[model samples]
Target: MGISAAGRAEFDQCRLIDQVLNRLGNAMAINRLIIAEGKDSTAVAAASDSLAEQNESYRRTKRQRAKAGCDGWQRD
Candidate 1:
């Protein structure tokens, strides 16, 4: 059976949410490792910070999207 238009939209939204969440999770893991190891290199620290920012941005964007009517995804 083919999916309805609404169902397809929901699936796409869910997929995008999943991808963003997975990226955030991976970034968090890497950030944790960097902090745990007590790394002091400028490049490493900068990269970690960038990852954190990106993760937060993704989260905020997801929230905005949800608030705008894409309610097919759930937060962890």
Candidate 2:
């Protein structure tokens, strides 16, 4: 059995449409993943900056306390 010319053309057109839709869906998914990763990295960077600032502040306070002789320890 053989497919008619018209039927084969219709099948080809359907196959092309399916391929385009699949590619579009994959592109959208990849774009979403990239955006999510960017947001996560930004959040992590902000948290890291905050932690570093807090650590610096703590160190400054410790130095002041030691300088005032309230730490009961000598700085060398």
Best by lDDT: 1
TM for candidate 2 is 0.48
Candidate lDDT values, in order: 0.74, 0.56
Model 2 lDDT, full chain set: 0.56
Task: Count residue pairs with overlapping backbones in model 2.
Answer: 0
Query: What tens-digit string does per-residue lDDT give for candidate 2 at 4-26?
Result: 99767756665555555455455
| Residue-pair clashes per candidate | 0, 0
* Residue-level lDDT tens digits of model 1 in 1-76: 9989987887787778767767877777777777677667775687678777877787787786676556645464
46 Cα displacement, candidate 1 (Å): 1.2
Question: Model 1 Cα RMSD, Å?
Answer: 4.7
| Candidate 1 residue pairs in clash (backbone atoms < 3 Å) | none
